[model samples]
Target: MSRASRLLTLLQMLRGKSRPVTAATLASELEVSERTLYRDIAELTALGAPIYGEAGIGYVLRSGLFLPPLMLNADETEAVVLGLRYVDQRGDEELSKAAADAMAKIAAVLAPRPRTHCAIRPCCPARRATASPTTRCRSMCSARRSAFRPRC
Candidate 1:
C-alpha cells in the first residue's frame, strides 16, 4: 500500500484503541519498521491530526473538533464537502492548502460512490477580506462572550 493509505490505516488502528498502544505493536500490525512508524506518526501530527505520545511511550489519537468516527452518511459527507469548499475558496494560500489537505483526508475515508453525492463546485467566493482567519475566528466568540460574562 502507498504511504498515504498506510497512514490512514495507521490512524484507523489508533482510533480503535482507547488507551496508548506501543510502537512495536503498531509496527507489527502495520508491517512496517519501528523507524518508519515513528515517521508516519510525525507526518500525521504535522497534518493536524491530534496524535499524542512519544517514541517508547506509544501514541494515541484523541478526538478533536472536526474528527468524529467518520461514520458519515451521504448527506453528512456532502455537508462537510460544502464547508471545506468554502474554506478553500476564501482562505489565504496557507489556509487554502490546509483546506485542500483536509479535503484529501476526508476523501481517503469516504468511498468514491458516496463522494459523488457531493457537489464539487468551483464556486466564487465573496470579495476578499483583509482580516485573517484568526481574527475572524475571534470575532465569532463575541456573541458567546457577552452571554457568559463573569457573574460578579
Candidate 2:
C-alpha cells in the first residue's frame, strides 16, 4: 500500500477500536514494522486523522462534536464484510437486502481510490441470531442519537 493509503488504514484502525492500540499491535494488524507504523501514524496526524497516543500508552480516538466516517483498513474491511454477511444470513429478506446494498455502496465509495482496497467476499459462516431487524435498527439509531447527546 502507498504511504497515504497506509496512513488512512491507520486512522481507521484507531477509529474502529474502542481502546488504545499500541504500535506493535498496529504493526501486526497492518503487517508492517513498528517503525513503519509510527511513521504512518505521524503522517496521519499531520493529515488530520485525529490519532492520539503516546509511547507505552496505545492510541485512542478522541470524541468530538464531529465523528468522521471510520475509514476501513484491509482487515477492517474484511471484518465488516464478514459482519454484514452474518447479518445478511441472520436477518430477514428486506434486512438482508439492505445489508447487501450497504456493503455494495461502501465498496463503490472506496473503490478506484488509492487507499486500502479489499474486494474479496468473506467466507466466515454466520450463526443464527434472534434479534429482529426492526428492533436492531431502532436500537442502533437510538444509541447513535444518545451518544451524540449524552447529557440530555
Candidate 3:
C-alpha cells in the first residue's frame, strides 16, 4: 500500500479499539518497519488527525473528532460497518433501528459511485454480552456527526 493508504489503515485500526495501539503492532500489521510507522504517525499528526500517545505506551484517536470524507479508505469503511453492527446487535429495538438508520444516512451522504458502495451489510455474529448497544450507537452517531459538522 501507498504511504497514504498505510496511514489510513493506521487510523482505521485505532478506531476499532477503545484503547491505544502500540507502534510495533501497527508496524507488523501494516508490514512496515517501526521507524516507518512512527514517521507515518507523525505525518498523520501533522495533517491534524487527532492521534494521541507517547513512547512505549501507544496511540489513540480522540473519539469525538470528525474525520473528513477524503480520509476514509476501504478498510475504514468496513470498520464503520463492523462498529455499527456490534451496536445494532446490543441495542434495544429503538436503538437498533437507529443504528440501521444511521447506516442508511451514511450511505445516502456518501459520494456517488464506488464510494457509495462502501456501504455493505455487517456480518458480525451477534454477541450475547450484556452491554448497551443503544448507548454505543448513540455515541458513534454523535462522533460521526462531529467529524463532519464542526462544533460551534
Candidate 4:
C-alpha cells in the first residue's frame, strides 16, 4: 500500500485504542520497520493530525480532534463546490463571506489539479419571486440541518 494509505491506517489504529500502544506493536501490525513507523508518525504530527506520543511510549490521536486530508470523490467534490457557490450567491453578506472562506480551506487540502474543480461558478437554480436572498439562505440552512439531524 502507499505511504498515505499506511499513514491513514496507522491513524485508524491509534484512534481505536484507549491506551498507548508501543512502537514494537504498531510496527508489527503495520508491517513496517520501527524506523519507518517513527518517520511516519513524525510526518503525521507535522501535518497537524493531533497524534501525541514519544519514541518509546507510542502514539494516540487526541479524542474529538478531526484533522483533514479529507478524501472526497469527484462527484462529492463537485457537490461541495456547487453548494458553497450557491451559498456565496444567495446568503447574506457575512454568510457569503464565510462560505467563500470555507471553500478556500477545502481547496487548500485538495490536490493541485483537482483544486480547479472548486472554482466559483453559477450553480443556483432560478430564484423565486417572493423569497429574498436572506429567505433563500435560511431555507437552505434549515434544509441542511434537517437532513443531517441524528435519527434515533
Candidate 5:
C-alpha cells in the first residue's frame, strides 16, 4: 500500500482500540517491522494524530481527536452521486440547484478513481404512473385555494 494509505490504515487501527496497543501487535497487523511501526507512529504524531506512547510500552490515541478530511470509498462516493442525481431529477428548481452545488463540492474532493466511480449511472427505475390524471400543485396550496387540503 502507499504511504498515505498505510498512514490512514494505521490511524483507523488505533482509533478502533480503546486501550493501548503494543508495537509488536500493531506491526503484525500492518505487516511492518517494529522499527517501521515506531517511525510511522512518530510521523503520525508529528502530523497531529494525538498518538501517545513509548517504546516497549503501548500506544493509545486520545479520545475525540478528529482526523483530517478522508477520501470517500467507492460505495460512499456512488451513494452520494446517486442521491444527488435523484434530487436533481425530482426536486424543485431551487432544490435541484442546491443538489448540483453539493455534487460539485463532493467532486472537488474526490480522486480520479473515486471520481470515475461517482460517474457511473445508478439504476433507478422510472416513477410509476398514477391512477388518475394529476395537476401540478403550487409550492404552498391551501384547502381554500385547491381541492386537496394541505396537511399541517
Candidate 6:
C-alpha cells in the first residue's frame, strides 16, 4: 500500500484498540518493520496525532481524537455509495435506515465534489447486466433487475 494509505490504516488500527498496542503487533499488522513503524508514528505525532507510548511499551491513541479522510478517491467513494444504496434497497427496515444514516456520515466526512456525487442521483452504481435472478425481490417485479434494487 502507499505510504498515505499505510498511515491511514495505522491510525484506524490504533483508533480501534481500546488498550495500548505493542510496536511488534502494530508493525506486523502494517507489514512494516518496527523501525518504519516508529518513524511513521513519529510523523503522526508531528502531524498532531495524540499517540503516546515508548519502545518496549505499547502505544495508545488518546480517546476522542478525530482524523480526516486521507485517500478516498472518487471511484472508491462511488463504490461505497453503491454498496450503501444496495443495502438500502435490499435490507430490512432497520438495516435500510442504518444504510441511509451511514451514507449521511460518509457524505459528512467527504470533500465537496465527491460528497455531491455520492449524495445526488448519480450515486447508485447498480447495473442491469450484473443482476442475478436469485436476488429478485418478487416474481411480479420483473424478469430483469438492477444489480442491487429490484426494478421493473
Best-matching candidate per TM-score = 3
Model 6 steric clash pairs: none
The weakest ten consecutive residues by lDDT in model 3 span 143-152
lDDT of 2 by residue, 13-123 (tens): 664565798889999989999988878877766766567798898987654412434467655665566567656767899998777766644653453431233234333
How close is every model to the real structure, measured as TM-score? 0.44, 0.46, 0.47, 0.43, 0.43, 0.45
Off by over 4 Å in 6: 67-152
Candidate 1, pairs of clashing residues:
none
User: Each model's number of backbone clashes?
Assistant: 0, 1, 1, 0, 0, 0
Which scores greater on TM-score, model 1 or model 3? 3
Report the error of model 5 at residue 122, Å: 33
Shift in Å, residue 41, candidate 2: 1.0
Q: How well does candidate 2 score on lDDT at residue 131?
A: 72
Residue lDDT tens for model 5, 54-123: 7677998864455333388865775577667767778899998787667655553466566554344432
Model 4 is weakest, by summed lDDT over 10 consecutive residues, at 143-152
Model 6: worst 10 consecutive residues (lDDT sum): 139-148
Clashing pairs in 5: none
Task: Give one digit per residue, the lDDT tens place, for model 4 in 9-123.
Answer: 8877776565788889999999999899999989998987888887677687775455445578776777687788778889999999788777756765675555666653455
What value of lDDT does candidate 3 attain over all alpha carbons?
Answer: 0.66
- Candidate 2: stretches off by over 4 Å: 65-152
- TM-score of candidate 6 versus the correct structure, residues matched by position: 0.45
- For 63-152, candidate 6 gives per-residue lDDT tens digits of 435546435897677567767876787789999978877775565456656655444442333345555665433421331123323223
Candidate 5 vs. true structure, TM-score: 0.43
What TM-score does prediction 2 earn? 0.46
Off by over 4 Å in 4: 67-152
Candidate 4, 45: how far from true, in Å?
0.4
lDDT of 1: 0.70
lDDT of 3 at 41: 85
